[model samples]
Target: MWQPLKEKIKIHWPLLALAGVSALSVGMVVALLETVGVLNLAPADSAIVESELAPEAPSAVLGLADRPPAQRTEALSLIAQQQDNQEGHRARYLLATDLLSQGRGGSALTVLDGLEQDYEALAPYVLLKRAQAQTAAGQPEAAQQTWQTLAEQYAQHPAAAEALYTLGQSDESTWEQLIANFPAHPRSVEVAAKQLPVATGAKQMALLRLLVNYGLHQSEYGTWLDQFVSEYGSLLTPEDWQAAGFGYWETQRYGKAGSAYAKAPASPLSRYRAGRGAQLDGQRKAAIAAYRQLAQAFPDAPETATGLLKLADLLPQPEAIKVLDQVMARFPNQAATALGKRADRLDALQSPTSAQQARDAVLSQYSQSEAAAELRFRQAQQQAKAGHYESALSWAQQLLKDNSTHQLAPEVGFLAGKWALQLEQPEVAQRAFERVIGQHPESYFAWRSAVYLGWDVGDFDGVRSLDPQIVLPDQRTPPPAGSDTLKELYLLGQDQDAWTQWQNEFRDRESPSVAEQFTDGLMRIGVGDTLDGIFMVSNLAWREQPQARQEYLALQADPAYWQAMYPFPYEQLIETWSRQRQLNPLLVTALIRQESRFVADIESVAGALGLMQVMPGTADWIEAQIGQTGYDLTQPADNVELGTWYLDYTHREYDNNALFAVASYNAGPGNVADWIQRGGFTDADDFVRQIPFAETQGYVEAVFGGYWNYLRLYNPAIAAKVERLAATQPNS
Candidate 1:
């Protein structure tokens, strides 16, 4: 959703309030002026200015957490004084929370009073807190009444679930009601954990459903699922069997899922999952039979096409090719991928001629298909990799000519432009780049094309001076699919409400449409589950579903699509660190986005911590060099400060080239130095291409791609300039 320009416009107040200035002593006024960057007499003053200003603009919600207790108290006091807006309510809430933590329950209750109507999204939470404060203040009867009111009014909210659990602590009747009314709530898991011991039949099944659907990934749920299957397998109904199968699937118990799904084979999805689960569980014969049955029974179903493709992969050579041919004939739009796989096998079998023949068939038969475009682009890549620039250029040109509207067309044009440069065809390269700019102005590669055309969009040294403007429309159009109410809730920033509504509405977990999955991802992100949301949305790029692909294509043109994909979670930390290090903030943001996906507390398996994924040893070295101490690497500000220092060090080591610095950041300075020596590559693009480590190569592309996306989506000036470039480019 597009925020109003008023919201986007930030007004930075001086650190010292004007009202207090007159009362302050002369020394205090000078100190305050120095703190706010008003004193510009010396280099030391600049350093002091940065240190004082950096922490002042932390993330709106998370900044309070980063502040010291004293600062937090002062901040909240200021906000509470202006109690007339959202910030005021937020401040009161935080102040109450802090007071409660300090055992000032009466004070907390005073702060929370009358905030119910003003904070509808957090009303249930306010009530829950009020109840807790009541209990702490020795008003147990009042607390109980508040809890009852909460449960009755906000039954679907997680706060209500917590309230019910609290009420259930002394009342078994409340516990039973909790289980009956909120079977899918997280608190119901606690109820089931207690009741499952003596439960039987329908009660047992219901408990299992609650555990499977809402419970955390724990061994106890696995144990309960196993027990339920063993005790009631023979007597369960079809729906129960299906539910059990879904439960098993959720837990990754593939073999058990297959068995449960086998009992409910009437559903096409169940049949497909039965096959997939059996295959994953190493029951090859059962998997084969299940897939065959699904394809035979549901010949016209979409799952049938997928079933045949899976069946092809499991079968022998000629038989595999025969099955692929059937898919190609029946599902032509899907055939290019099928044909490409078949071609790979042919090449692996020492039949290059047959491989070429298969690829040729796809191009000749389905030249306008997305598969054809993909196959041609891949062929261009293969030719380029083999040093046959002319042949690669030919394939790329033909791909654009034949599949102009295909998703990969811009990619082909970009590659063609790169190949033209390699082949010393500047005119051809310019035309190709122009075509990419004109035809796919929204793509990252279009930005690349713009840069190559000598637009001052920004580079490593010059980005600091570039004032990229981001233009957002007054309103954002909702996604083409999903419940209107859920969309509205999301737009209003009521993520919990949207998530709860989505959980109730989202059925057919076995086979969701692309739009459903994308919406699910959005809801997941809204609820602070960034990694799962990223996986759900990013995985759609490779989806074979025609409708899903179309939906994805449609979304690509929207700025919100990119923003959702590449969110700037820790803006203050990244900006502070980047500015301190004299680096491009967008570039730092790109690296952090790649490293941690904005998960502040995430640690890689290699022990890298926080937003920048700084390793402990590296942090120690950086600390020693900078004379900084007592820094927690798991903290966002500290991690980014150290990471940017390391990044700046790398850039200086490489004479300020971002390509080498980014590569070094991933593979380490030693490996990157060795690669530079061996490859003797001077051009940044050439250096990137010749990097031996595939992971490092991909990382560079992803980081830079993130940078381009940030510029296009967030910076209005750069976005407008690029749009103008696209408009001026010759259409042909």
Candidate 2:
């Protein structure tokens, strides 16, 4: 019986291979290796027959191979299948969520429209989202109606409350009513208070009082002051009026404060402050007269010093200097320290020549003060601007050497490098660039240096590059084997019959591969057939373009290729990068797929190489700056790490404009930025067509299209919407 079964297995080798080996076989092999005390198999597992096995265990090599689309699509499909999408409801809801994330509120409403009852519990949510979408899509009346309905039907829901608040914000009276009705709601309170004051707690009341007294009011300024004086008259004492005047003076509303202070004659402080306000208001003679009177009325008062300074500064320059000298003589040792400081300030306020003299005096007298240090830096900048490179360099060097840990150390270093470059010192410029890269890899300057040297450009990360010349076949046939293992064996030994079987079986699973094989393989994986999925994928290109997959076979045979494939669990790597960079995992995976297609040594039409498809210029620039030129860009880990960083940089540069930045990465910033300056685009679709470069235009469409599909397929929430949208929207 066993012999008959064996014979039967021999006849149907594909089925037997499926039964004897699988993802589980890879896991078992790994476990067996571990059990034998292999400390780190990464270094010594070349002969391992992990992914080449059959499908008896369906849990092996889920993330192997250099290809990304097949794997990412499979991952998304498997994940979606594991989740429960009840009819079109879940899919619709997911579609709405995805639409919302992608800033497509109107589209989201269309998705939610068909699931009115199915999404009833989420109806208020959908309505609120619809309201926002309506507003964004320029349907204000519709938005208002949607919000009103939400308020009427689901007032208790948070979304309903938010919708109501939004409606109130659209109209002041309605907002006031909302606040009056829902005083406990913070948004209502905030909205009402913005127009009409509402002092809730003690702190709030205090802030309101301060705002009324001192806030920059828009013609409503005097209204608040008048209200405060009327309602809180007892609190508005002479001193309060004086403080209000000071507030007015601080806000440059000297006229209003003076009017308030002039009304309060009992407080000398108010009168003095009012006079100062008058001075600040450009009524210098009036200020001087007021100060003189105050000084006469209160000779020994503390206000005398302020009054004297006002009087002295108001005098002609020569006269003022004479008065300052007299003040020093008469008030000797009484306010001597204050007098000297005042004299120095007055001197600094003099003409530029005099100001320079004063700055030198201050530096000599008080070398440790912040003002002196600022003066020094300012003088240095002036010298640099004046083309006194030697003096500028000397000052910068002195600052760096003296203030070793100064906040301006980097600035000085940059300036020094610039100066050195101006002096024709390439070695110095190179060192400066290296210093920035070494000491501040995260700095904008370092990033600029990398770009200048053509290294690690964020825009070039993970570019989809194919060296159409070398690895690309000259037109070959499909794998001949019908089984994955036999196919592997035949490829290993160049057996034509087995290779043919491989090709036929691969095509049997999916005849046309426009990203559908990815979904099919993932479906197989979801149903507990992991090895089948990988086999379908790794050998997919070979189904029709056997030569392509055959080339991969030869490449895969290299231990280094397996090393790249085995060490990284693709899902885990994607997950880690996505989370750290605040990006979608499937998006990152899709980028990697388009870029290297997991081929660590792939090169592009633009001369980009390695897993992330970095340009040679960028690689060289990065090498020089990092001081680590020994790295092989063909290694997966190095490629991934650098690619991730570059992606992060591009994401940051474009204000998280993934579509624009990704396009820029492929086409070039000159093209993208130029297109952006052209304007008039309403949405991503419009923007896509408006792209002038045909290659970049297609690249953008393909990447984002791929990204959208992956996002929907992998993330259950996104997948649901994608499926629903695919059914409903012609574009999807």
Candidate 3:
């Protein structure tokens, strides 16, 4: 039987202090190891792999992208076994690709013979491949004919652009035709780069913008921007300056970004970014002037609060304290953080009495403020850490009552529930968990609440038995902005058309609306650039723009909004692997979302690869254990197959304890075992709260949070339950 913590226990602050010191030491060690390249933490793997593998050969065969080049032989062999169905058709196309890669152009053409009708989506690619093969086999006339056929038949396709570029090797007119007809295709970048020196005025500006929007190489773009600015700085419009600022900012040229933004727009956000850029560039006086100007010009803007905060950081203590006080008085919700800083400064100045007074003032004057709630929440954490569960519960409850609408409300409510469980107050804990679901269903903590309530979604044991039904929304509203044609393209799954259209029309990149950002992310995802797409969508949660935040908050009220946000791409692959491993498909999907954001070829700094981020060493070990070989971690199917097997293995190690399994997956069984031994944590919440590694702790929350989001967004029963709880809330 599971035992809750006893209601009464001796409490001491010194014990909590000791725990904090120990956790900090552990964190430092982990950080040091990571800094020196010893710790192979999972989340950092993607960035590492991307930088290391970027210059390698492209990892796709007939659009089966991200597979390792070393696996071409294995892939070809696998495709040979299935030559009768749709898989067989795909296999043949890939087989041709493999042959072409190996300079066996005649063999590749032989394999591609008469398959044009069968591979409709890949027809242009097949022809292009065949043409290259012909050229490789020294049949120049045959290659020319094949390229001409592709150019004539697939003029609108990207393959046509490639074909034109190839034909342009001997004829400049063909390149000019490519530039005229397919200006949005990537090959146009190459054409424009070659022609940019002779281009003038409007044409030059247009080409520059295209280069920036398409994310050209940094060295090349920087040279282009510098040359363009030097020649045309005085002739450019505010919009041109804005575009230049965005391009510079994206490339981390903060000094240039600031200079450009200073001349671009007078919007609060623009001014803030200008100041931020200047600050980062070490232009202290200019940054201060920009901040002051923004504060005076747009006092009511959300940027003004941030400006004031930054200004305080640069000012003398007395001036800083005054600015901090102003921030707390004007932006109470945002003020708690500023006030906390003020309290810390007072203490640091050896004014303990003053610090106490300042803290008391926040509690009394801003009792209903977020700062007060934060103070109370901190106190609760301290009490809990000190083993004073009853006191912690009281403070947490007070925070809930006073600051229910504050951003920290969900976290406080969840913590209160955890403390209640520690105090053996099951009923109180249940209500607290219910309140979290009712009031803040979109939060990661809401998922934690669901786990405690024994929902089958990512539950320790229930996941093994419960079969969840996935219910997708029947109708999705098109994004509010964008042309009707572009919207239609997106709705119709004409991803390339929609992407090109979006790039051409998406003008305010610096200050896009929440909807526009979301749409932009969707467009990027649609075009198979998962990294940037996921970055854009996931970044919305941190936006400080008042209007954008309000729009996001309003959108969160709708279930469809979340469904779009946490989309389930690669459903067939996820389902096949989940079923094979006897796991919930949604759980597998959630894990993939966290691991790689569904980016098939993303590698982490720790060298974890593909959708589930399995490390190379782990893959080798799993292969040995499962008696499987020739699996490519970069390929989606292979990665998921091996990843899910590892997931299942972890579950079995802990007797289906999802919490332990997830932690073990991230930090490894060795580290998890050490933490378990050190903390002697039996309860899930207790173990999570006391987990020494902040990285592992966050990973657990994120994985389970993603699991709950999938459930409420996709499972009808869970969605209805969430809706019902939300409807019963006082705010609702």
Candidate 4:
């Protein structure tokens, strides 16, 4: 529904990131910052899952496992002693792991003794930990024997891969077994790395292929794949090329991907990718030829349409018109855009008559299309820029007559209303504002309309203090894909193990099923990988294939997608600090998600650090004012406390106006002060459009849009209001 708007405007919400940070000191700090949350062993809502075991199981996950391991070991031990039932398994395992990690392995061994027999479902993990405990306890022989037993007995288990990896540290042949049996195991990456320098022939190719296929999309894998192509290009099969091409493509080595895709299996997609990659790689002639070949070979395929458009971009005005003419004739769905592009080409060719005819054809025949809407929108903007309010209103109304439900309609309606106010037409402005709030309650424009139309949603200045009720889900959405055991592991808060198991199962990295990708995203978030997690989940929107897009739509029909996209990370810190600063918690959370995506120690290009992206200079100023010292910006608590205090300061600077404060946060005070002083805006929304900086303009919308999503997704009352408003509108 919002697809057209996506091309015309930045939606700003559901911006999922594919998150992974390398093991820098900062990475360790992020882990430490998020580990307590990652523990998932803390007190949780009773409704964490729904099952026969939901009562005991969720508590089982929480009863003894909810606290940080180091802080709550003895408490877990006491709980384990109290309950030797099924729940004791979790308690004991937690106790044992704590003991092992803290180097009291003998104590861990006593706790873990015979746990394999009792906890049959987690027997492999038990055995693996037992071996680790043995090694840590200086029982080298016992550890060796235990590793051998695990490798020999549970060789098929994912945990057994770890055992084999450990044993292979001393024996090369054991790694060979690991490579042969568990190619997808993460340990295989290690095995490949360990043996890569010494390997040759099929053995060497096999290691490279393993890394290429399941190297976790690391940067080095791109270099390795390049070498593999260099040495064994002739020996590689089409399937190998497909994998290699995907690796190169993911790494943005478009030239390599173009080369690899040329050798991959002949298909519309491969051909399109080959051309597209070539285009991006700046091999213009190759790209043009590939695109032309694709259009000829797969005339009816969707890729041909995309390829043709790209092909036209490489051609001159005259030649581009011909390609666009072909698109107009062949693909009715794309004909509007084709006509619009052709009009520009015709104008560039100085054939004004032909250009007007082309544009008129679009407005008359494809009036409802995104192209027509955008064309009309441009006209409106041109008139508005020229101070022709009446003409601008006419064009915006014409745009809405065709596309009232489009993503841009809300913005247009709001603009029309604002323009009406400029023209002193109060009734027309009120009706236009009503249309925006009625049709697109989720949009930022609706929030503006609500404030102008006198709804109680709060305004730019008042929104910061309005503490809307927040609601957490009764239970997390069940996994859309993966094994029951995978679900079990996830539900139990066994984050590391679950992620490892998921990695072993999720082999179709290049072309994942929607459910698989969504599951992948959820697991990533489970392990404090919010950037990647949100990315994997939210990127489902880009699926182009019919089945994939259908699956994506089905997944999105549920509330799960939105919830996961706007997850409540670092809530404890956000709420505590927000209360401390007398700011809205949701607003703080929105800013944090926008700033660092809940990555505790993330540093931006501008040297802003931590969850709120506070600059060192600002932090120093804040410290001097508050008389606090020695606060690390990388720490979540420290960052939030400082950031919220600054947020408060910014609010005070603008007389408690959130709009000005959020703008100040991104563009800094000097720019904001300048914008405010030079403002000719009618209201806050108009003020946004007048902001000279595109990034700051978008930042204001993004931050507020993020805030609205949090409120809509987490606040039941506001959600019901949005739904009620949407229900009254025909195509909202």
Over 497-527, each residue of candidate 4 has an lDDT whose tens digit, in order, gives 8888788888778778899999999888888
Clashing residue pairs in candidate 1 are 469-715, 469-716, 469-717, 470-715, 470-716
Task: Please state every model's RMSD to the true fold in angstroms.
Answer: 9.5, 26.1, 18.2, 10.9
Alpha carbon deviation, residue 300, candidate 1 (Å): 2.5
Deviation from native of the Cα of residue 228 in model 1, angstroms: 6.2
Q: Residue-wise lDDT of candidate 2 within 580-614, one digit each (tens)?
A: 66665555665776676555666778788876688
Cα lDDT tens digits, model 3, 266-344, are: 8887788788889899998898898888888888787888888888877778888888988887875567668767987
Poorest stretch of ten by lDDT in candidate 4: 12-21
Clash pairs for candidate 4:
17-531, 17-535, 18-532, 19-531, 19-532, 41-65, 41-66, 42-66
Return the candidate ranking by TM-score, descending. Answer: 4, 1, 3, 2
In the predicted model 3, the residue pairs found to clash are 44-605, 45-603, 45-604, 45-605, 45-606, 46-603, 46-604, 46-605
Candidate 2: 10-residue stretch with minimal lDDT: 1-10
Better of 3 and 4 by lDDT: 4
Local accuracy of candidate 1 as per-residue lDDT tens digits, 1-732? 111122221222222321221244434434433332222222222343224221123223223432334445554544344224444465566666666666767777887888778766567778987998888878899999999999999986556777888998988778877777766655677789888889887887777767756653344877877777788777777877787788788778898898899887487888888999999999888988999998888877777778888888788888888888888878755777788778977987789999999888878977877678888888899998889999999999998888877777876888889899999999999989888877776555776777777876665445544444433332233444566555545543456656765665666555677777778778777776777777777877776566767778777666667667876667767777777888888888889889988878888998889888999999989989989799998788888889999999998998887778888999999998999888766566667768889999889878877887788667776677667766886543
Displacement of residue 49 (Cα, Å) in model 4 is: 16
**Which candidate comes out best when scored by TM-score?**
4
> Estimated TM-score per prediction?
0.74, 0.30, 0.70, 0.80
What's model 4's lDDT at 144?
A: 92
Q: What is the lDDT of candidate 3?
A: 0.74
| lDDT to native, each model | 0.72, 0.50, 0.74, 0.79
